[model samples]
Target: MQPPSKPAPPEQQATEAGSVTTPVRGALASLSLAMLLPALGTSIANVGLPDMAKALHAPFQDVQWIVLAYLLAITALIVSVGRLGDMLGRRRLLLAGIALFAVASALCALAPTLWLLVAARALQGLAASVMMALTMAFVGSTVPKARTGSAMGLLGTMSAVGTTLGPALGGLLIAHFGWPAIFLVNVPLAAVALLLAWRYLPADRGGAHAKRPVFDHRGTVLLALTLGAYALAMTLGRGHFGARNVALLLAACVGAILFVRVELKAPGPLIRLAMLRAPVLGAGLATSMLVSTVMMSTLVVGPFYLARGLGLGTAVTGMVLAAGPLVAAFCGVPSGWLVDRYGAQRMGGAGLCGAAAACLALSLLPASLGIPGYVAPIMLLTASYALFQAANNTAVMGDIVPDQRGVISGMLNLSRNLGLVTGASVMGAVFAAGTSDITGAQPAAMIRGMHASFAVASALILAALAIFVLGRALSKP
Candidate 1:
């Protein structure tokens, strides 16, 4: 299962003409599949949540916790696991993650109670964090740096496909088989991914190197506390805004300060705070969070408006919802090529501006509009995100050294998960507040709520764009 001879480093591979050999192609394929699973799992669960609620007879808040728990685990553990992968072996950690994810999916499928399902999902999410943290590093380490954007584009395409197809697929399965079908479907696919990874991905030569940095236990603990408490406060503070939520938020603030202090003093930091001092990396990470927040807010609200408010069937809703990511998926490869040909700054800025415009358009849509009204705006929004993701990721990774790719990958993923949690919590609360006084039958109220959510998302995206522009301006010589 080892490479016949040690392959040249990625930077060296980039210089050789036509270096995408069979082994390289194999590695990309393996990484793409690994990336697809988590994205699909997340989207499928979003589509299937109502069915699970009905099957388990759980309250709305309880069922929402299933997604929240999964997100929290990933946000808390991603950086630590990523550092471990870099120190140990990325291939080794990725395989273990794939296996554990498969088992956890089975656990989720078989869980008899809602709490058990949440627990299994949390386990599944932890495994997903590992994959998320290392998959980009795998690509960077295996593929040539010259073609990094193209490789990332392909990976991005796979993720967009997962997001694009997941709702439709989940709706079909749930309608015919049940909510559990969503979980069961992952088992065989994960088994296949595990096999491919075992055969194709490169072994970590760095693992044999002595003088590896020590694992930062204190920094890891502090980061976990910071992310965990923040996620908890964001998730629970909506309706249950009590002393507990306040305390948790305060704890998160303290934990963040402590984490910074510990990382500065630690011999081996979980995340190199100094790396974030680089404008490209920091701005890229922040932009990712903002884009994800906007997208997730729309995702959380759009389906509800379509299904419950408009009385559309799940199948129809899924089809309508798929349009955005489908466009994004189709554009992914080109977006990457564009980043390589031009530059990340240009592409990233253009994407953000497009996204802002789309968000504004969505906010202006009225209650009387049909599914057709949303198609163009959704497509524009998701396509913009795809463009931004491909370019921004390339920029961030390109700036970092080879050895730090794993941690950077984890940080990128951490930003996305945190954004999702924040968006879902804040946007859901906004929608709920907007519509709370009206009866469920009042579709207009729901539409108003949806518009409010979009408006808030638009404002956030604009703020993000402002920050990005300001940072770029300041960084100029």
Candidate 2:
């Protein structure tokens, strides 16, 4: 089912003046839709975790691990897969990822047990990693450099919309159809995206079939170790702050050292460490981690607060909880535009400031007040998330040269997920600690903790900014 990508009448290909046809537009739409599929599944799962556990008869931590495992695989493999895509063929890899994801998703929907579901989800993550790490590259392939910004801006908002819609959609599916419905939703989206990707997306035509592939095994291993160890510490450190936690942290440090060494020595490293020396890329990646914590924390606490604390139904909670990302949807495009026009440093700073202010507002909410009381803060949080994320993405991707773009994108994506995992652990602990003492009124206390956690998260954002500033200072001419 190859697409009819005729050389567009030599004159059209030669001159940029020839407007794209409806067919080409459909093709691009198909690619854009494909770009968004993995996110839909991930977002749905985040809000539907409780329902998933009930259906699978799993414990809370185990259910959490299901999500973690997917992320682990994605984070660990994205960098390697991404660069490989650049060297080989991004569209080919993307289609492969789409097919793999569809099958894994089917497995998840029909899983007979929890373990199977976990394994399926890990495969899904791997597929998602490929899609996310290379979709932007795909955009570059489809559109000229002049049109890339608008394409990127639209894609950014599309992600925000997907994320915002996912929770509500998942909740609605779970309410009547049960947890499997959430996974099942992917069947149609993936099927269509796969079709378009197969038919429309162009082939990669890089420096292929030339130099021997210098696979960076050392860099790969060290990165896996670093992220894995850090995730382990976050997942386990709570309730037992002892030798185990220390060892995990030490392991992370060791892996960081090893990874730096590998990047320094490899002929063609997995992630070019020299790129990290760029202010925009480094700052963007650092901020990605910080903003991700906000998502992790919000996902865990928001559902719980709406369902258990306020006694609102999960369905209602899903609707209410979609606000943050919905706001993100509204702001994401403009933020990308801002990143293009202004320096990433300035834009990133502005977003951080907004986020900090939002957190302060969240902290100020009293238990006596209701959801409306929190609405303003939530809106701010949403706007800030959209702005920061768009800024970071543009900055990070903009910093790198074309050849290494995929791997760099993967690394940046990994940073965002790493932030999410970190946020989940830290915020979960904070909320848990805050609720430990109370018996009947634990709900109120939990809200209090979540609010406070937002405060702490805001502080972390500032810390990230400080790092960005320091990096800038170090790079002074």
Candidate 3:
């Protein structure tokens, strides 16, 4: 099939070479800050979990919901909102989303009860979804294609720093002030991003002349319901669904079918699913999900091992875990160079292989290895995570037509978050289900369980790599 015919939108085309404008860079810088804010809260909150339960007098379930609610909202809204940006205006959506996110963050910080906190978290998620989707679309629209790889790399690094630093900052804040410090941290940053964006980012052109713009409401509803059901099934199917789990799983399958149906039929489709028939695009997304699952598994299972099983202090655990992403922040910009040289395909394969090896090391970690021994494996895992992320994102966006980037971004980004949630649930199931002969005094049981979990993680990553290989081999660039 001939590639989608898209002469650059006249509004965006540079008719003639022009002098440099500092404001565009200023706009990107502001966007990078706004994009990083959501991550800060997410990573930091992991460390603040105990404090949250204590302050809110909340049960374990309430705390889980707080995180889940935020993720769920993001998962549902991101793709649809990205499509909204494509139709309405990327800059408009981005600035408005930032404003909404700021308010939600404030409400979260001020929340008096667990339910109130959950509600605020959901609001935060929706707002974040909009911010993330539009900012990415805006980046693509604003930058020349030749420079897109590098632009995306810097943006990825910013996000990595936010993600990596979140916990360390949270740990420090909780130690010094209290739990609310986490949400409060976004205030100044958000204000700065808001002000800079208002002053710098160029106005969008998509809806400038349309009196009655078409909205893809059917596609949006189908996508939301699909993801919502899948989230529910995953949440409940972890032994909670019993005999009905299969039915719930089938329901999720049905939702996927319906989502595709709605997308194909909508006047303004939520996602151009047919476009993603490209094997390269498919590979990129599959690898993205795998890498996401692997990284998120660490966030989920690593804490338990540090705080309880091995008896390390929570603060120390957060710091130790932060090592990988901290290193990744430095590595992110360099990854763009690698992607340019080796292609995202090779880089993704290498990343998965490295992660698999890291998992193997963790699986085989001997009791005699001690602290220094385990650090290498952990760092390798996170670094490979860093490697694949910048690369995989490039590959996906690389193959897509410019106009469809937001939809691709939304779909791939959702896949990554879905992987994040699934990782926790999957590893949790693995940890909870398996019996260990080694407990109290005998450490073998704990080691065995951790090893099995790592091995399972490795298998998942490998599966993703395999899909990438097959899909990429089958598709044209």
Candidate 4:
């Protein structure tokens, strides 16, 4: 047997011809903080929605737009901005994004009307897209190739932390101050991140090193339309199903077809469909999406089961639910170590198995078993997501050349967002279909719905596992 290789040190390298050396330590902290803000921002407002609605005197339908607008903007614009980062410069774009996020956050905090707040949130989402797209690009560029998994692990850790904190923190802020406090919280985080990023991050040397690529204006627009329509359809499918949802879904399908055609012919495609044929890249992305779908399903369904099925209060349910993301956060660094040592495929497969097991456990366990039973499966599901994300991200980014990191990162983020929305749509439909009448749903009916949702989620994860296996088989030497 071969002796274990020594781990690689965190070393700096020049990301461009004339760029300053990538600061491994500082860059990790800076990038993690930058990534954390948007992740937190995405969910922080969820707990504040009711508070905001009350304060603004807005109906539930209008308040829904606050979250929807942000999500839509990010989904629509991230890939284009990521490609822009590849063209213009990651550092330049990141700084601009941070500044914009801060400013928009302020606007959200001060907005007197629901419509104005929604608009501010949209702007914040645009800036967030830039930050989210470039996060891996910057990290991948900063760290040595050998330690990419470790760095990605740290990024995953921050993401888990942000997700865990968002709701709890938002609730606290809303109770103490107001809904505006939720938005105001971003100001300090973004400011600190911006300062650190400005001081330690390198300039746009990657763009300088590579030949100037033509911007694909047409491709960007079509892709944006596709994502926008798709997101809207998914969001609407949760409840507001009718002509609007059908029309938006149809529009999404048409936009997707148009995007494919445009990209195939465009000199500078937003996403290279050919490049996506690579087994590692394509399979990694698919696995990422599936993993997120499973995770999101648990997230959306678990709370309902806890509160409605088990008769737990919101506070207790929230605490019980918080266990998953908290475990995920703790799992990140160790999972990164595993990825760096063992390669992504093994870890990714293991993670998927864990997810499948968690889904099965959740499906089988009765709500009568209470929080104890839920805790174990939730931890497994959350940790599995973090594990899969860390390894899959390393694999995908590793497969790409440095020059295209921004777009790939954007694509990865896009997949995750899509998975989240898709999971919500699919699982929500399943649960709703099972319940038939939510307002008059009995505990038994709700429990049945939860079980059905989890069963479907497990089946989906198994399918993803099969796909991963096939991808490996096809990629073999």
Evaluated with lDDT, which candidate comes out highest? 4
Alpha-carbon runs more than 4 Å astray in model 1: 1-11, 46-65, 110-116, 174-180, 206-208, 237-243, 304-318, 366-370, 432-448, 474-477
lDDT of every model, 2 decimals: 0.84, 0.74, 0.74, 0.86
In candidate 1, what are the lDDT values of residues 136-186, reduced to their tens digit? 888777777677788888888988888777877898998999989999999
Better of 2 and 4 by lDDT: 4
lDDT: which is higher, 1 or 3? 1
Instruction: Please list all clashing residue pairs in model 2, or write none if there are none.
Output: none
TM-scores of the models, in the order given? 0.88, 0.84, 0.86, 0.93
Q: What's the true lDDT of residue 79 in model 3? A: 89
Cα lDDT tens digits, model 3, 336-394, are 66776677778877877888899888877775665556678988887787777767777
Better of 1 and 3 by TM-score: 1
Candidate scoring better on TM-score of 1 and 4: 4
The candidate that achieves the highest TM-score relative to the unseen native structure: 4
What candidate 3 gets wrong by more than 4 Å, as runs, is 1-21, 49-57, 174-178, 206-213, 235-250, 304-316, 434-442
Q: What's the best-to-worst order under lDDT?
A: 4, 1, 3, 2
Clashes of each: 0, 0, 1, 0
What is the C-alpha lDDT profile of model 2 across 1-477, one tens digit per residue? 999876653223422543444545555676567667767867788777887788889998888867777777787787878888877777788888888888888899899888889999988988888888887766544554434444566677777777767777887998889888888888788889888877766656665567767777778778877877887777675433578877998999898998888788889788777777777677667877877887677776777666666777856776688777777777867776776677556776787788878777776677556677666778887777767776666656654666777887778778887887778777877777766653354677767766767778778877877876776676567
Residue 431 lDDT (model 1): 80
True-structure RMSD, every candidate: 3.9, 4.9, 5.1, 5.1
Backbone clash pairs for candidate 4 read: none
